[model samples]
Target: MQGIELTLQDEAATIELGEDLALALKAGDCLALSGDLGAGKSTLARAFLRAMADDEALEVPSPTFTLVQTYDLRIPVSHFDLYRLADVSELDELGFDEALSDGICLVEWPENALAALPKSRLTATFSHLGDGRTVTIAGEAAALSRIERSLAIRAFLRERGYGHAKRRHLSGDASARAYERILVAGEPVRILMDSARHTPGPILQDGKYYQQLAHLAEDVIPFVAIDSDIRTKGFCAPEIYESDLDAGILLIEDLGSDGILDADGRPIAERYLESVRVLAHLHAQPVTRDISLGTITHHIPDFDRRAMKIETSLLLDWYLPWKRGEKASDTERTGYFAVWDQLIDLMASSEKKLLLRDFHSPNIIWRGERSGFERIGIIDFQDSMIGPTAYDVASITQDARVTIEPDLRDIMLSLYCAERNALGAFDETLFRRDWHLMSAQRNCKLVGIWVRLMQRDGKPFYMKHMPRTFSYLEVALQHEALAPLRDWCIKAGIL
Candidate 1:
């Protein structure tokens, strides 16, 4: 898509452009504004700040003398005028890295410090066009595309000479795919897209297998199944109007704003209990049929035991370094494997139930209504299998990153056990022992996964959660059932 082009004829137009840009600004965004003196750079910056901060009268003076001005908005905003800098060394002294790490930055005369600035920074060049000016914006192709869309939408409104207001929204690959599939399938669906990136893959389909997967998904997921048969007596997921599973495409119902995760993005207290209930409901139904896992893992390009071991070795490789601030020795590595072997054995002995292997925070949505806990919506169940219940429970309570409050965790565990007892399949003591064992195992695997995310996938965001995952493992090791494993971790120096 082409980048957005805007012609500013008056102060109102400039402010309108600022508002448009504000909608697209995210944390850590850098905007380089280049223009001659009196090009209304400060005026445009003021408008952008006002749109974000909601304070129209906020002062935004030129940083001619100071070189940089900072503003505390919904997120941090930095205004820099490199026009006055004597050398790039001045920027280094001013803590430029600290500012960019936390907020959006606006730099005027960025060329003066070009060598020292980030390569990915956005550039907005302003030039005098008759009484006003022409603004040319360039940045990452995706960001530029958004700037273009905003300009188009703004121009559409301006032609009508009426002010427009609406809640700001951002679209990701998943959302774009959802929209594309709906268009192709001729189905109406409501989808709310967010900026979070959980899994890695394309979000839409352009081929036959993807279309077939979408059709199969529509058949299996409960939401669509319920719509097909009104007599079906269960809360399924909302009908997926369209999907392209191969492409990660989906056009689904808006499950509303009440997700199982709290407002601060933490998993809600009852989530653990609700997840177990869902698993019980699924497993209660006799499996009088068969199912396939998927082609991703099935079609092994080249499966070798050594290769698999190398891939799994990433747990000790990356996680141990980040956690211990050093790499594991030969003896320590052997101990790690021994612990994993024991945990796997424990998992094998547990009673098997249908397992959503990744039944963790991101996969669940909170419905908030409180009718038999049907409020919880499940996603990412394509990896579901017939496995032990402890696996799913471990995925929820001792999540790799998000820490569930102890009080809530205890309450939810009690609720799940009680529900199983009411259903005549209760084994509280065994469940407790298995729960700790599984939690320790899962966290161990997560430490590896998180490390892989950073070093292999080139995503460092997961690294920040390493300490929490280590802490979970530490607590799990302290349990009486996990005493041996705890000692092993200590011997390996992972404790």
Candidate 2:
């Protein structure tokens, strides 16, 4: 969602805002705060705690030394201070997980737990602005939706001059009408706007509109949220003016029709290297407590044992039938299932890292310049996860629709590996081994996914990419680590 830039008149306004937030919070919620030492971090915390329960003796001390402190309230509350932490691992001793299970957590100096925190939590950053302060709040789907409701209520209050509206228009009809007029007529409307439109596709699954909207916003809105900063630093995306996460809409600057994939059907050597470099920079940015993997995991359903089994079944139900034009024999099917199981186990054991699950050609828009390398603009990155690094590398090199030149692919991989080495400890040999293994694993799962998209979802456009996807699988199977899968595919006559 787009961040609202506000200028508070005084600490009273800040405390009032915090009290309003406290009244709105529920159990299992998280609010991460970041700002300089005296920017009212503890002041806001005190205000929130006081509002939760009338415990005047509640010693809401600065958690600078303890790292975290918990207070028993009507709803459990945990206050954390990472100002003294040396690294994220230091949080392990504080029983943070237990707190997350049944409390509303308010964290101060959250940067210390950046890597280990959840991806879908709320974040509030406070900064001094002259004699007052500026606070920016952001969160995942549920949290953002909650905040949106609160904002709507606040807007209603302001509209009636702090008096009540005779009848609240909470059905969001006014909002929808406002958006339509602004979008279709280009008439200036007070709400956020965007250029993207809904085209023919699968009716989004039942009970998933908000989830999907959140996903879309996560992917698209952030470009506008940070567009100016990114552009000044030499990156290209869209410029976002406003976003309402609760309404599932965004007002963003449109990057016109010349995407990199639209300009070049196949990735060239220079473009590939440049793309990899951009990814390296993105991953290398100092992990901020403001962003974390914790929130993403918390919002999306986890791949539990049952979900994994169901996903594996797709190979038999969709991919095999699509590829072979007939049902697989029991023996052949059993072997394929075994290979899938083994790959899933390997993936489960690997170390997790940030992965933009859909990194590929079509998502990279080409904003042309003499420097062909840096002209690429990235999109469709909201589904990024704290998964294997190789997942993203493989997503690009062995892309679904376009075939990356072999020489370019190798060069890009080498550049990525070297960059990783420079940043942290990495075993080059082991990294490459895992990279190949994960590549094979990703392609196998994707084969089933694409087949399901075509057969079950009636999206045949995805089927057009099967030949290129198969080529990636073929190369992956050649690696020694994936020999069992290679042999299994061959024996089943599906390689």
Candidate 3:
């Protein structure tokens, strides 16, 4: 799992390797570089730093004289040149420990401090190979595994005629999936999805993994199936150009960068209304459960009582303890479940449609130039299921990332209801009830998720949305059906 060898034909190839490494390594990582003075160690380090900064023209002077240079970029980096006969004790004065604690470290002439470098550090050794250079990368199994997968993606893209395409990081979600935009010489932009198969966590219940119990997609089959199915039904899902199901990689159409939010991250009313209209058009008809591809059929999972309860219980399992600094008592826990069980029973009888579990602003793309449903580009529907239509409505109205003002939220809801009413057989009263119910349900899950993200996942940025979520929960709690849960939350000091 160690010692990956690559041959770089010229300076460009070496720079590309450094760019690829930037995507693989993270904070608290150290890459030890070793080579002769004229070798490509310093070149590779410079390229790596520039890539990390996302600036090819970023001035990165050699640290040979100063001995160390640090840049506080996205994932802060420290460049150290240790060829000055420096004693190992000099590292203590150079703040080596603090540097590694805060961000990544790249050491040239690591041989000078062989006893001081971390054993888990990745090592990249360069040597002259014919007219170019040969680089050997060795690292701990976990780090090497990341690099291996990244190289596999390069191979996949190369086989698909995008070998020379420039890769730029777009985003990474809460899941393991990462996305990159591909820029070719004279072709339309494309997207590369690196959804490596991630089977996370131990068996949490019923001898199944947590993802299995929650009906989350472990690989890319569900995404491919759902994307194909939705596109066929006139939705504007991205077109898939290439796929490696075994490797969990995809080269798909780029759906542009226009979203329903503005530069300040506020929701645009016109775009939000269009998104609602698109959903109304969709939920008016029954969705096919089993989607067929050329050789494989994917059956969409059901948002059954078990899955819903598992989600709702997160509020009890994480949020309550996190807020109150202790676990809920047995009696309080029993009362909470009793209320959710009743709510789920009521939702079980509502109209069912394909529910995009996360239909928020982050997953939506605004195609203003296109008309009708084509104006909305949908992504991140892999966890979609056959569930109550009101759920998706709630997801957008009370978006997790953006705040939808009260008047705009009402207008969006009215647009959806009016559209469905014109389509016939739509009970506005029943839909409103389910809307409130689902909103409360969704907000509960989000409150717990924000806390869980901070407490368990070491991501505290999501916690900034907690107050907004709590405010949304207050709106949902005004409903009479959620009175029991609302009272419980009030007593629990969360309402």
Candidate 4:
């Protein structure tokens, strides 16, 4: 994870490094500048600080005499010049711990108080190399690993003829994957997807890890495969420019910023209608389980009983315990899975289609210039699988994040059924039945996921979506097929 000797050819190169580092940096990260006065440490520090601030003209006077300078920027930053400190004991008076805890810290002359500095911080030692500068980075394993990944991303871009592309940070998902916009001078903007190889967790089922059991794609192969197939089918999947499958890096075409949501962050009727139509069209098509990719074919996993059971078990494992403050015993766990197993099997009434996994607003890119279903640009489909078509319909319409109102949700269901039945030989009644079951299952899984995100990932932001998710679960469980599960929840006082 650690990188060594990265030579900066000029001031611009130094600035570029800072920009790239800015994408990798988070709050509570510390950058220890251990370099000679003329080695451009302050210049590099200022470059990073300015980039994070998104204000290149923001005056960043050297923290030489001021000792520490705080910025009211994105993810608050504290720049410290420890050169004049009499002893490490002065760190407490300067609020050093508080600065490190709250923001990204850039410490100049960190060698002066080396013993006081945390070992987890990245230390960049800069030295003169003719007119340029050479920076040798060293840090604790985790810090070094992150820096190494960022540097590898730099190399990935360079190899793809985007050596001078300006990297801009983009929003990340709940998953570990990271993304950035790579803007080249005279070329179309592209996305830099950092889908690092998933480090497998402990075994969960039949000697398989949780991701494996859940059919989650560990590398970028599924994404590349699914994207290629999606584009071939005339949808707007981002075109891949470069891919290092082993390294888990992809440079793909940017699909612009038109989302299915409006400026108010609410779902637009036409856009959402088109989204349902897009799903209907996809479900109607003859989709093969295997996706052709050059000489290698990617086989989309089945939404089998094991995966479904494991997913639903998340409710028992995380949400139920969190909500009730008491874990389910062996009898309850077995009974819970048995109920979902029967409910999920009811979804087999309709022919299976490739479940886009996350067919919701957040992942849907709206392209106004395109016509009909093609206007709905799909992303975040590496976890696609052969499953009941109703699953995706339930997913988007009964979205856990967005509250699509009851009337609108009804309209969406009708629109989807109209499109699917228009093709003839479609069973409207069966689809709705399966849709209800899928909605319940999906919402149940989501409640658990939200709780797990809060307790395990330290991401309590998803907790706000729980009430909506729980409400959807109630609507889904209203179906007679989900009575046992509903009764169990009521008995457990979770309903």
What are the per-residue Cα lDDT tens digits for candidate 3 across 1-495? 378999999888888888788878888899999988777888888888887887779999988888899999878899999999459989888998899998999999999999999999999999888778999999999899888888888888889888877777778988789998887878998999999887678877888876887788999999999898789888999999999998999999998899999999999999999999999988886789999877888999998877887787789889999889999999988988888899989886698889889998999999989888989999999999998899999999999898889999999999999999999888888889999888988888888888888888888999999999989989998989889889999887886
What's the best-to-worst order under TM-score?
4, 3, 1, 2
Better of 1 and 3 by TM-score: 3
User: Model 1, 319-419: lDDT tens per residue?
Assistant: 77876888888987787666656655655556666555667776666766656636666654543445557667777776655877777777767776777
Poorest stretch of ten by lDDT in candidate 2: 167-176
Against the reference, the lDDT scores of all candidates come to 0.62, 0.63, 0.89, 0.86
Highest lDDT scorer: 3
> Which residue pairs in candidate 3 have backbone atoms (N, alpha carbon, C) closer than 3 angstroms, thus clashing?
none
Model 2 alpha-carbon drift over 4 Å, by segment: 1-239, 262-264, 285-313, 328-337, 347-351, 368-375
Q: Write the per-residue lDDT of candidate 2 for residues 1-495, one digit (tens) a residue.
A: 445445667887777676657645677887889899789888889888876665435667888788787888778999998878897777778888789888898888888788777776788899999999999888766676556555564454445343121111111210112111112234332223322322334443344442343243223333333343345445565555555434344544544445445344756556667788777665554322223222322232223333334444556667888778998788877776677677657666554554556677766766565354356676544444455567678887777778776887888889988887898765667667667876776677678878877766656677777888788888888878788888987876777
**Alpha carbon lDDT of residue 30, candidate 1?**
86
For candidate 1, give the lDDT.
0.62
lDDT of 4 at 13: 88
Candidate 2: Cα lDDT at 362: 61
Cα deviation in Å at residue 150, candidate 2?
A: 25
- The clash count of every prediction, one per candidate, is 4, 13, 0, 2
